[model samples]
Target chain A: MLNVTEMLEEIKNSPYREIEICAPHTGRVNFAAIQQGSKVEGPHGLWKEKPGTLLCTLDRERNPKPIAAVEKGELCLLHSELEGCFVEAGTRLAVIRHLLTRDEVQAAILKKALHLFTAPERAKYYFVPEIDKKVRTSGSQSVTVKDGMELFIMSRMKREVPLVYTGPAGLIYAVYFTHTSNVDAEQPLIGVCPPDQLAAIQEVIMRVQTEWTEQG
Target chain B: MGKSNKESNVAPAGGLIDVSSHKVLVANRGEIAMRIMRACVKLGVAFTAIFTKEDTASGHVRLAKELGGEKNLYRVSSYHDANELMAVADDAECTAVHPGYGFFAEDFRFARRVSKRDRKLIFIGPSWKIIRELGDKINTKRLARSLNVPTVPGSDRPIYDEMEAERIARTVFDFQVQQGIKRPLVLVKASAGGGGMGIEEVYDIDNFRSVYRRIRNYAMRQFKDEGVLIEQRITDFNHLEVQIVSDRSGKNPVHFGTRNCSIQSTGLQKRLEVAPGFSPDEINYSFDARKVLDDIVHYSLTMARKVGYDNVGTWEWIVTHDGSPFLMEVNTRIQVENGVSARIASVKGEGGVDLLAEQIRIGLGEPLGYNQQDIAFNGVGIEYRLIAEDPDNRFTPWAGLIERFGWQEKPWLTMHTHVPTDVPYEIPTEFDPNLALAIVWGENIEQAKDRGRLFLDSLELKGCKKTGGELKSNVAFLRQKTAGILQF
Candidate 1:
């Protein structure tokens, strides 16, 4: 059994340039590493040297890169907070930059998931605009609509912005845009529109990015 | 853009090669085709029946042969071109053609082609020019505006995008507010289509985009044109229409009073109709709206005379709570549920159907003896559209043979859309959603409704349960909705 905070602290100090987390069959969240440049060693020494890594952008054509290799099986953690959660035991939680020392690489991974169990949450869902097309795509395709295409709220409210989704291709993008509200603590609040109108009806999703600001 | 390449071709005028000898051909199908065929029989003219492939076994086609000589029957393709239908008339060695409603009824191009290329076939019903004029929604709206006939408020042009949709919605919302109309709703509708097709309602802004997209797809699919218009959604309204007939001879036009078709499906799909909308005072029902009918006839006649809509057509209107009548769209051909009007037109003589005889006479330039002053009613008439679908399943359309058919027939329960047995029948998907309807007339509205319920309950269709329960359920729902039973 591993301590959640200590593991997160070790991973934060590690040297991964990009990080992604997923609760399989549920959802995936990703973030780019902020480390400018770092190098790390591998178990196989001089004969097989790994390249140093930086927070460089991947080509537009590629999907996000993965860092951890979580086995496709259930996991159990002793911590009360991670009771129902699954994290691979002894998993190499971080992939370091070729330039960083093993110690630094481990530290970066720890910092990233410092509040792993208590972190605020957000959700995104993809829905098929029409039944036939979605079936054809098989939920693994991507459609490219030009940016600023006008997303609408379930109510008549609309804003011109493209909805980007790394989910099912034929489905329109809908997300339970979760955020911390002043009114509630423990539970994250989300904004969502009506279901029937979630499909290719409107282009951009009118998300409340800054509720504290008054535009009018 | 290129002047449409469409022109109304006029027939070569003369006493139809030989009025007594020339055969009349009806290049159509269904009850309307039968209606026209009956008119031909009265003229003492040898008749020809041209049927589509699907209608070869139709009761109408079969009945046509039983009434007319066997030599008059001819078969054509169901999906064949309209010109092919006209050619069927020519092949049958016929002198005239009557395009029954549905296929080529409002097809001005086909009408012109029949009158021009064929030269001999007299095009019955509206002149091709009138069909061209009123067949278009935008042009008709313009004409209505010019005639001071009130129509639903909305943009006069096709709404192409969301901004325009929102703009129109905002304007209409504002107008509704200014007019003191509470909780006003709006509708996005396709201009070219009719019969409740390609119309969607938007209750609030959030749903507008979704509704607009659906409506756009439907409009494009149905009319093959994505020209959609937005209008204020009218609620708690009564659908009323006056049947008007005009002829080229043009002495005084006839108004067959008003029929109330208030009971309707919420959307632009098939609607169930009830006639002689319930009124406590028969003489003074919808008085202001009745005056509006007079104005509507005047306007419709002006437009009809200009375009030349002879034969049967309806000047449709709707009455709101303020006791004001607003002009709805005009139906160029006889309405499908117009069996009520058919019965009203029918005069029981010692020998034959009186109205049927009179309609034929009017076609050939003769007087219809019954005047406005002579018009009187025996009872109330109610007509219900029997859609071939399962009601519990959102009315998904059903197509198959009607194996068994029986209805509660009372003295006043005159069932039209006569699917005569003694022959096989195949109901097709090409036309209306409604396969058939049972029209019942009574001493009053309640009696008519009771007879309607009886006819609906008694209707036994075996091939598929034609939702007699759903129809009865819907009628009950409507009665409650209109507060017909609950009204003080």
Candidate 2:
């Protein structure tokens, strides 16, 4: 069996990442201007427009409306049945990978604190460290964490339960919550980073947050 | 100072009501919210509306702003969150909350919360205690039995386990044998379910176990209640209901005639018409159509009074081919078909006493203002629900921007829709697909049918155009049903 420290280290070192393009509204896909494995710039490429440029059209009557790109990245995994297909709003249209160096990617992840656990609403949360903080950070510059491990607790009504971590294993970059206290749902309670997999982890976190905001 | 006679008649349970200064928060959406807003306008009361993020640009939000001003319109995340809705009501300083239909309209917890809130907001529908009593089918049937109201033959208690289900099925089979029913049918239903959901039909004894499990699973998923009830399924039956309005005093409950909604597809009501003797085929089924209707009205009022029901409600019943009416269930809120019934009632010279307005009046501890004898059942009205679905594509829901919505002007027809013209409207991906309803009233059923056909043909919703044509409405189905050429 792998020790808790080793498991956390393994999670922090692993790297796997992808970005998805989602449909802005519900309609029939008129056409797809770009194919998979196409390198594109922010807003413009095969579709030929700037950021917020209409990549394709969705027909809802005799009039066809535009579906625009929100960011600039290399296109990948274009849906096979894209043309003449009905797609609901918020459905993932394609995946994209941002072309960046290792140092630039790490800077991007740290700048936004994209690795933090943002509270969904205002509530009291209790932190429960899985491993001794001293042992996990003795030789490292950050705290390590693993997926499926409980690190915090939230009390709702009369029940007290642990708050689960759904993201991949990562290192705790910053600790914003020093005690069990009430915080706004929009506030980020902690900052985390996968030491060697910042790009992959950031991609997952961004996609999840995007979907969450859209649903709200 | 001397006390007035009207003041003496006020019920002690409700205390003295001051409707003149009351502010109501409408906790619903779509056409129902508009209906309630009209009532608030007529009564000279402040109205409030709560909407979600999806409905920020909806017509209901605009209507609420127009009626109650900007402060009265609130945008919440979810309609099902009772605490948030109550908080909005409190912030708005509403005197009462009117749950138009669906959502929390029949939720006993919401009613209790409103009544128990710090500010003590009044609920426009029935009291929470009464809602709890009638919401449970088992208790409703028991109360109906005690009041001598006819109910369908079924198990007296809820079936708990597999053994209990089998036992009830055996008993139903024996009852069918006694009634000389060769092709016996058993209906398994959730004790706390409504809206034609969580129901299953069992044809054979061997299939009882699987069907029961399936229905129980569905009930648990949908209503969070696994308790099931068994009832006999009437193969040939006519769907009918009586519209009744009562006050908190419970002494006077008046029925406003009967409505026939026998035409349905996949358990959803497609078309509804007021009065029974309109169609020759329908009249042929019953020995005396007038007497049957009278019986329905009488029984419905009787049960309403027994339950001490308040506000507007519909006592639904299923009339078998033998002309025996069995109490199916009770809808504690205003239904979609009420538009047609209200139109017919207005034509009867009732001075257009809107049902929603009457419900608010009753909530204010006022009487129904009129008695059963004063109601005049005149003219025929038919309503067709135009759903945003494809009939050719197995009725798949289609959502998109409505570019062109065209409907000709007609005095006889009244369209109840939230879709705005002049500007493009986007039908969201979530919620029910019911886009609008078209209600047409005439001197008689024949005239109403003719006008309905014409109105439907003129109406158009140019959403995402399919390969063959535009998105299909229920126009074809409504036309065929009106002509009596479509089979139910």
Candidate 3:
């Protein structure tokens, strides 16, 4: 039921997302020396121990704090006018255009092909305690979720209520929300893969890994 | 000039200390910072405030901009950075620094740097020497024992020798047994280790040796110190603290009575505090609550006088269900529950006494102007820590946008908060999730509890997360606990 070639073709046509960097608080902004079209790398290395490229520094109360890029991208525009000037919080400092990598493209295609389990209500979502421990120690892909299984703890108004899964039994292929984050009602919380679709999912991954190329 | 100044205001024995020319840098954030700034204004002294990026929309920043006017508020990167605070102080030309409750409040190094730097700034607290001396737990115990003030019966020094350690343990057990304690517990822990590491509790005296040996060996391997401490584990005691205020000349010190802060979260964080420490007339306590309160106050003042404790501090104590009281430790900084004590306090014939104003007045090189006879206590005051947290889930902090937050204003209720009600505010995750401190007062304990319940019922706190889920608060929990306040 999934068309891998068509999904890859659709992503190849337009494979970029624009990200705007905003000031986290009121401060004097100073743009790190960067030119338009300059390449920037996001955080990398195992455990993300290495920081990404420095975009600028926000100086407040004689203390300078570094702001780094969150995604690998090309510098599109810099708000140089804000340099050396005091700016309020939420001020847009820069715009970056990032090219979608093979991993991201694979993720985009998989989201469409997999059976997505959605949140029933707009609340903070977390895996139930026992499943949470398992998911944390192992990966989400190793955990199988089934219909009527208590899979989540929906937290709202300081109270926690258990949420039961209602989809086909399958491995949790993707997790859309972290324990600290909130999810909207009817939004996908996890993408599940049925037992028979394992071959198709593996084929999609194999094709993307072998055929997809990174754009310069 | 001395004669005229003495006639104008009650000057100390020396003369009136003119601190009108001084400016203070409030080195903190949120409620305490706002309190300090307001105190500075009341004392006719200029003050500067600092806030990090996330706290830009905090009520303190708005208050600073309104009252302090232009160039008085600085945006800081972090509240924990001393260099940033000092640099701001210098840039703002502030004459002194006020380390409110946290951050640099208890750090002697920061206090020392504030005084010892080339361009010195007065640290609005005890001198660095006093802070250093009392900051050490062992030193504080030794000081208390030296003055014959009652401390928890334990070995004050590290027990390096097995024989001496066993002797101290035997004495602790025998003392507990004499006190009619059932199944006495002994705590053995590595002296150099902290945060519950290298610690064990022995319920049976026969198990003490094995636990001690294990902890000592672990301490030697992990902390590189074979030293261990042996003490009787105390539990089921009500927590109490005495508020001590003095001038730079620690000679004439006074107390603002005591407060009961035993109702705490599972993590030992205080949630509710009641003034006067105990309610003997209203609630029939197992002990002589009135005498216990007086004893703690007396012992606390004694230690304050002995150590020349100059500035605002708290002497923490714990009273067993029986009448025995034990000095726990000293917080050499102004505490969060200071307002509850102030609420029940009055000066001379005037009912409204501002202890923060008093602290700033004396902290900025001024005299106390009054003594014990001028101070008096009236009424029962209860302070509820209104926070966005789950009471059923170990008080886990809830973070989200507070769309609406307010309560009915009453004559007896004093609310202190940094959350802005006029605008939708996002709770900052870096700090405590405390929304406000609502202190309600009454003529007696029953009325105070009644008003506390009424206040909680009147409170309107509504919010939501990024997910459309509603905000969670301890308002109901607070309402339910209102009846049991200050009870044994």
Candidate 4:
């Protein structure tokens, strides 16, 4: 069993504790050129109303990752505005919406409110071990990398992320984890992990599964 | 009255029809009803479209109004309500009634009721006596035996208990031993129904009681009869059937063509039907299939002639693993998949009319099979009967007005039927949950199956949650298992 009073006390104490998640694929603006201070609405440029910056990451597998500035904000595009921006898997990103005020979120209510809380401001940060110091300007550098690799990278930086996308064509597994009791009480939980990603997602699942199995 | 209202008021009523005129009331729904209604129109006779609340919106009713005018199209409570149907026919002054292969199509009581109410309501099919007689497995088996058609060893009557099923299985084993059969399996089959009703294949003797009891309960609920017939299970068998047409003048039996319904789940209801025969490879695998069909047809015709079979019917024959044929059953009226026969018939220069249309045409003394020998496959006609059900709930029938019916056209196929707007259909709990059939006519079995697969993908029927999509997947699985190529 969980002590509602202790869980509530912990939630109160940590109400404003900040958690940062870096979304690596959110800020690469492709095909962009800077005219000192001139305003231009090219494919790679940020919207005229709001100016933003981009960060890039390079992977060893010949695929470059771009993190756009828009990834730091809430998903605010109309349904039809976002057309074809794609994010590959394993790109580190964090969602940091302010879920609840210090007075609102209690452990007793948290059990029934997974979807009710607001998400945090999601910010993306990219990492490339080799290109930690590399920076690119329009039209110069990386011409030999590919025909228009810089341009391609710039154009994608500001594009809105598609909420839904197709996964790579291969096997997929759906894992479910059920929490059987409150977190403070160290109660049982039920966890499920797909066979392929058993090792990766298994730790979280086993704890939950053990709780649920024991509770039953 | 305005022209439209005038037209609506002027229901197609021929001049004062005599009491004995050969006016026909079609007792069915959908394309079959429309098809039979056409026959009445062609004969220059009055046609009455007896419909349920659901069938009011159907194409058949509209066609009746077109042919016989507005007055000819009437409504009924239910097709199976024999007394109400008879009263409607009498009120319409119809001389005959055609049961179009569903609802009351195979029902003996409906036919008998109509006949009793109006002696001249000439039920345009096999007699009620024949429907009842051939309906019973025991009697049909005996008839098959008399015609020299081989039958699985079993009793001629419905079994009452587990002991009877075991006893029959033992007898079948002994009979198989005498015939040199090894490890023979027995099937407990219902005596008085078709379409794989209450047929359970039992391998172990211990499983016999449960299988028997299950089928017994199912048969009792379905046919109002719990009697069962036991037969030797013919494994690795190819199902073949002959379409025989006969009438009052004499038994005019002819083999339209043979179709192999072998692509099905063993010991269960038939799922897929491919007509005009399967590939040569299938035939080669079962060497005696063709000869077996010939024998079965010969014997079926003989039995029909002896028993005074009228109009059109089908004789079901199954070929054993050792290339021998046995009489499985007989259907006394139109079949759900008779579109295959019509498709082949049309390519040979005959009119593209289905079995119900053929029955009407034949009954009216129309010439049939003018070029029977020349008739060949136009292509393969594939059909999937849609059953309304929740997919997650093991596909139980969900009854209601279909909310959506959708289609996407392709160049290779043609859809022969259209939904009528007047019929308000609900899934009746009393009957099989199948709502409608989706048919695809293609150039070959492969092409047809391919079109069937695509057609299922594009089809959308609103109102009821349907299993056509699921069945489409099942059909693909079956085709793959049977090594049938469905190139799309």
Instruction: List model 3 lDDT by residue over B1-488, tens digit each.
Output: 11113332346576656666789999998888998888877667789998887788899999999889868988765777787777778778999999998778888999999999888999999889889888766789999889888888788877888888888888899989998988898889788654235667778877778888877866775557899988888888899999999988999889999999988876566888999899888789877889999899999998889889899999998888777898877888888899999999887767767777777777776778778998888999999999988888867678789999989999999999999988999887566677999999999988998899988988889999875677888888878878888887
In candidate 3, list every pair of residues with a backbone clash. none
Q: What is the lDDT of candidate 4?
A: 0.52
Q: After superposition, how far is residue B143 of candidate 4 from its true place, in Å?
A: 2.5
Per-candidate DockQ versus the true complex?
A: 0.01, 0.03, 0.10, 0.01
Model 2 stretches astray by more than 4 angstroms? A1-216, B1-17, B157-160, B269-283, B346-348, B391-396, B465-470, B485-488
lDDT by residue (tens digit), candidate 4, B284-325: 543554555567767877888778776688888777666677
Model 2 - which docking category? Answer: incorrect
Judging by TM-score against the true structure, name the best candidate: 3
Say what the interface RMSD of candidate 1 is. Answer: 27.4
lDDT, residue B145, model 4: 83
lDDT of 1 by residue, B1-488 (tens): 00101110111232221234546677667766676676666556567776654455666777788888566775543423554455446556777666656667677787677777724566665567767777766677788888776788878778778788888988987889898987878888877667665677777867888888877765664467777888888887667777767654444556655677766654444345544444444444434544554565566666655555566667777677655667777776666656675454333222123333344344443334344454544556666666555444444444445666666557776655646543334455344434466666666656666666676667665453232222212333333333242111
Between candidates 2 and 4, the lDDT winner? 2
Give the range where candidate 3 chain B is weakest over 10 consecutive residues by summed lDDT. Answer: B1-10
Query: Which candidate should be chosen as best, given lDDT against the real structure?
Result: 3
> Candidate 3, B471: how far from true, in Å?
5.1
- lDDT of candidate 3 at residue B120, scale 0 to 100: 95
lDDT score, candidate 4, position A106: 32
